[model samples]
Target chain A: MITVINSILTILGIYFGIGLLFGIYFFLAGARKIDPIINDSKWTVRLLLVPGAVATWPFLISKLFKTEKQ
Target chain B: MGLDYQTILWNKHKKVYDKLILAFMLMYLLVFAGLTFTFNAQTTIETLIIRAFGTLAVIMLHIILAIGPISRLNTSFLPLLYNRRHLGVSMFLAAAVHGVFSMIQFHTLGNVNPVYSIFTSNLDYTSLTNFPFQVLGFVALIILFFMAATSHDFWLKNLSPSVWKKLHMMVYVAYALIILHVFLGAFQQETSPFTIGFLSIGFVTIVSLHLIAGFNEVKTDTKKSEKDESNWLYVCRTGEIEEDRAKIFTVDKERVAIFKYEGKLSAIHNVCKHQGGPLGEGKIVDGCITCPWHGYQYLPGNGQSPPPFTEKVATYELKLVKDKIYLNPEAFPEGTEVKPVNC
Candidate 1:
């Protein structure tokens, strides 16, 4: 049981680590494109949203690449 | 959209909504507690509190989720949409109470940290009957906490409406986690058919309401129209639009709302700048297009918020050919001053 719990914890840690990295990238690169309303926000406010950003990155990615109709 | 924020900018409507919510919560707790004490006097107080709050929170969440689709299907239900954030925050508080009492009751007095024991003490992941349901509840609680903490215009302004909206969409994820938590946890121990039936009904109701609302929207969007000379889409006869009301059109997959007010016609992007609400669905209030969702307003001519505010939306050029409204598919840059054509 101890070994199984440890393995689960290890997998969770790695998953969140990767999510955090993607969150950092989203904050730096894709936030403005996905949402122009954040243009005037402070860096600290942006940083606070990192966890949520990581969790919802798939939706952001779609918005980032969405082409506006002519 | 106010220049400054209060804890809550309470109005008569909000005050009444909040009072109703509180009354319902108190009544639910009272009845639940009374029934438990009468039927099973052996049950502890902590267990009673946990079950009562947990069930109430889930019930409130169902109501919150239902309000959106119900309002879409019938506009009279829009009153419920006004103070929905308050409902969300209240639900979170109830869930927090359930979580705290649960943690103290089950995981405390152990050799390890209560928070740490929550994850490590229940390691039966391979078995469906014992799959550490507490962890699922914990994850759902974390998501709810984030949502409730940021359920303010301050976060809306700082995080941007789109990102804030995306973040709040995690409610669906939390809902799924909670469903799993209840199904695998209490259902395993209780094995009562009534409880399982109730949960199944709630699940089906939410899913069906969403599907029905989505189908209605698709039907509206797919309505056919015509085109005119110079390739501009023919929206509708000017007479089709009522005074101070808008006729929404989908031009090349983008929604445009053409409003007729004060003997003039103007077209603007249908999505509101504040929360992507349907501008066309709203009526012209005080000579400005008011968003039905939150009362965000914009002048129809320039698609800009009236002076002292800076929000803007894209505008489209319109032509009047003998009372027929022809709209150019191209959108001008947001905040551009477009001349309104006299009807």
Candidate 2:
């Protein structure tokens, strides 16, 4: 039981860890493309996006590429 | 209506609202602690903190849930709805504190990770009373944390309003989990009539308010409209709609708001671009139909936001004949400029 729980936790950890790295990159570069207003938005506003970005990085990645294609 | 986004677009009203929230939270915590210590002198500081925050979060969750229905029932409660995200975040913060402190106090001495221990610390999955309620709470906290993280308009825009709304609706799931957690964990051990009664009352109140408000909304949506030979729906007379206000009706299963403003009548989609707020519930402010929930405004004529703001809603054609209003059920595309009919 512990092993199964640990496995789930590890997978979640890895997912969110990758998400964290992607979040940083997205905030620094890609966020502006998706939301042009972000270019002029305050750092605090940008900072507020971090947790959401991390949680939904896969969606963000797809959006980034979609925007790039556009 | 903002050209740029800040961390929070603070106004005097929001400041006052937040200050009131802070004062209320502090007073509640102090009172809870004082009462707990007076009644149970043997209670540890950790237990007091855990119980205090846990109960506070539960109360906050009940209030948060109630606000939606209350606002739906009465527009006067709409101001509370505007800053509701702050209350949600505050509730999540309180829940997180209770969860973390409880985990550390109960599970930190184990060999396994504390989070992992939440599931493994109690093996009794079959028993009703011995169920690992902490696990339910941990899961609820995760849901609340996710919701709190994505509560900003940034997520609403990026994820799309529909998707964001769906994701946030997981609050119902968290609410269920927390209810089970309290019943199985705290109530099982403490067995205090007061605590049990409080939880029962909160749960019943939230549920009853939602049902009442939901029935009222359904009554509006299910209203039948008379139709002309051309299939234009017959709405109420122009006089029925108050000046600068709207009379909402169901047009082809979609809600449409017909506003009477400055001797002209115009119709637009009732749902706001932001948060799906009911535009009909909001009065025309500054010559624009403002959303009651978030103040998202749209031009009465074009169903488009005023200059520098790009949000828009679908417009419907309206005809005013001898003070009788008729509406074409077919909607033009969002941002379509339909001419308003003079009343």
Q: Which is the leading candidate under DockQ?
A: 2
- Residues B101-214 of candidate 2 have per-residue lDDT tens digits of 998899999788888788888877778889888889988998898899898888898899998998899999999999999988765677778777777888899999999999
lDDT of 2 by residue, A13-56 (tens): 89889988987986787678778888778777878888888888
Q: Per-residue alpha-carbon lDDT of model 1 for A1-70, expressed as tens digits?
A: 7776667767756666776787898678665555555566666555655655655555555555663331
- Runs off by more than 4 Å, candidate 1: A1-70
Pairs with backbone N, CA or C atoms under 3 Å apart (clashes), candidate 2: none
Q: RMSD, each candidate, Å?
A: 6.5, 1.7
DockQ, 0 to 1 scale, candidate 2: 0.72
Model 1 chain B weakest lDDT span, ten residues long: B1-10
